[model samples]
Target: MTKGGDEQLVGSSSADTAASSTSDVGLVDETKSKGNTTNSTTDPEVDQPEVKKGEVPRGPGPFFYIGGANGAGLVSVYCRSKGWQRIHDNKREDYKLKWCETKSRETYYNFKEGEQLLYQIPNNKVLTTKIGLLSSLREYERVMNKISTNLNPKHVEIPDPKVAAVMNPLVWVKASEKFSQRILKMEDFFPESFRLDIKDEKEAFFELYKDTQIWICKPTCSNQGRGIFLLKNQAAVKSLQARLQSIEEDPVYKKLPYKAPQARVVQRYIQKPLLLEGKKFDVRSYFLIACTVPYVLFFGHGYVRLTCTRYDATSDDLTAHLTNQYMQKKNPLYSQLKEETVWRMERFNSYVNDKFRQAKGLPKDWVFTVFTKRMQQIMMQCFLAVKSKLECKRGYFDLIGCDFLVDENFKVWLLEMNANPALHTNCAVLQDVIPTVVNETLDLVLEIFNKSLKGQRIVPLQTLCHFVLLHNGGA
Candidate 1:
């Protein structure tokens, strides 16, 4: 039917994207420092440094370090390619900045009080958080209320210390409160969820969700598919009784020091999920915040993940319900479902756009429009959930990952927000995308860090990731 329609709408090189998407909150084009950005549309290969035809990238001024082997290999390769050195002991090199998953006193080596990383306040230099705020969002319900009280989008307010905690499944009550306050009311997006603590509470929520078609029980603070299960009805909730009996049998776990909230959130399950080839899918989004409140950069391209097997509500198997990549990869169909397993958002657009437009009710760009708006709202709410407790002095930067589930009606729902998501480029699609974003994110960080050092306003550089100002409270 067509002679020469562009077959590769989404396959352009990262360079093309970097050049075309040079937007910033304020000031000059954030893409390049002078006439350095290349706009020519060459055969798309994510070019190898400046060797591939683009202008030479600026030299990395400060050396960096990576702790906790999460993304060390990839960062090592990047460090070598850019002629940047990675230091082992901070004392061994003039370590300007470093990345680590956990915030320990040991992680702050060689840096004085003012040095930056991700840490709690009272620091002279900006520091990043070690826990759930790789992207630096944690919900201090009390503090959140205060931030909203004196809310000035044009000015930053020093938040007071109010019993602080970052978002996890445990804060459904607070999330519910905020969702109900919104004009459109998205309270239904998040299913009815409640915490089960002390023996008496379990039976209450069990009765609460007793009539729901399905329910899911999740641990308050855990990762990598641990202690998660799906329950279809009252009979299924009864099965948890056996597990609770076991926990009661052993008090050792309760004795562990600095324990996370020993709570479980039971949420009503979405019986009708939007599926691809009958498999449940969820979109993943990422953000990095290295600056003060209201100012953060959003990555433009995030990907989608699909379940290995078709979603079967009746199936007893865990893989059919939980779409966690760490768990889904173990399913035997994971290999056979390679293309169906993960997708670049651009690939998703090319595939879904025309098909979605074939119908008359929804707009052609609904994904970019409605879908994106929903995402931004969720991200902003999440940030507000913990804004007051987050320390955003100089030198503090973080990367965060969020997951969302869309129902059959294309209604997006926030599944969970995570800090310090595993940075290893393990998936096939990740080999190309992960390293590129990591590199670009680092550059943006450097740009800000250098600017902050010289008392200059920080402007975001062109992004492989989209940078959106969720809110802008001037400092």
Candidate 2:
């Protein structure tokens, strides 16, 4: 097992064994003949599909798993564990790639390497690769259509970015400025100063909250606590500004840098954060939705990420200020902490379970049951709002990570909704949960396919039954 935080490599051969089984069966070719000069289809055996000028060819089946390159590996591992054939191969060098069919030993679909394959299994499943975009509306529509067709439903549609902005703008938080604005809007949730739009009038922010002890600055869209700062005084901000300016002048920093500079946000520092043994941390809750049924499910597992140092609202205490994995690893505290006392998801779950159990009025499995139900309600509301606004159908969001900040009051604040949540199964907690999660996700896809087929078959069966009854009665 590899030891990196997110990139931990757990040697699980179940996926490999499953993949081998599917490959041994051989590939089944299901290409339809198009007898025309213009509608030329590539022969899988001889010539690879021409890297065409237009649209890439759709795969023979519906069942795609699109995620980050790291996520792709995890999904592949999970799919192989279940003995399901993965049609798309990222390692293939040929521009034109194909879905391997184990039964017939042939490729079913052909498209360019790194090109997103729109897959649809006739009456069975469909999946597509996730493509990166440079903020193009046409490209967004194309991806939406591909997802809709792959799912085979009109109501299950891709989420519109515009609609998503209204429901959960965290997806667009690509800079610190946006993050600051978002935090300021949450003043009702946080009593601290959450000022925004003060780039030109930075004094307005300071004037309103001059008495505050500490403030944290963050870049809007970055994750894992990058480009975050803790400032105690005007001199601290000035000093940090000088450092940033120095970094800007560095040759290496100048060569590779962020495209935009005005994406930072600042927040009033939390003074008395609830802590375990003086360390600061936060929780990430995993949520899932099945588009067909419009249902939400939460994994009964998540880990607590603890900063390695005791709570501090000072600029010098980097570990105390940032509760992120990257920062935690660097802090000497992580090394000093007892191995049994280290933060882990399963331990957190156990703690929640025990706490709830000990409470007089709380229901058993209250955290799992009640929290999941509320999460579902919130998601349903969000989905309905998006659907009404966007007029889309047949799109499923299989997984999402909802970050939460717990106050002294024990209230949970929805920090953000991660649309494309990372799915690495390397962690011990994730390793156990991931296989089940993948199975459930795939099962939902299969269910939708079966339901569509059943609906189509129902009409003909009912018609035949009515005709047979009439004929027998007349006889």
Evaluate residue 369 in candidate 2 and report its C-alpha lDDT on the 0 to 100 scale: 60
**Per-residue lDDT for 1-475 in model 2, tens only?**
1111111111110110012222232334222111111111221112123222223335543233321232344445444454434443333324211222111212212332123221221111001000100011123335554544444423334478776456433333333344333221223333343322234434455555443467777543344455566777777766655765566577765676543242344566656665655666666555444322222223324456666656665548676766644455566656565242234555654665676456535456644565445444443333332232221123322444555455444444444443334334433454455445444554443343344434432112221210111011001
Q: What is the lDDT, from 0 to 100, of the residue 250 in candidate 1?
A: 60
Q: Which digits, one per residue and each the tens of the lDDT, describe model 1 over residues 1-475?
A: 1112122111110010111112111212111111112212321223233222123323554455554444545555665566765554433335556654433344433444234543222221111111222122223334445554444333333354343333233355555456446523235445555545545656777556654577777754455556678877667777787667666566675676233334466666787887766788888776566554325545445678888888888887888888766667679987677556787777666655765556536676766677778887776665654554444456566666667788877788877665555454446676666666667666666565666666665444443244555543433
RMSD of 2: 18.0
Every model: Cα RMSD to truth: 15.0, 18.0
Each candidate structure's TM-score, on Cα atoms with residue i matched to residue i, is 0.69, 0.50
In model 1, the worst 10-residue window by lDDT is 10-19
> How close to the true structure is residue 194 of candidate 2, measured as C-alpha lDDT?
32
lDDT of each: 0.53, 0.38
Q: Which candidate has the top score in TM-score?
A: 1
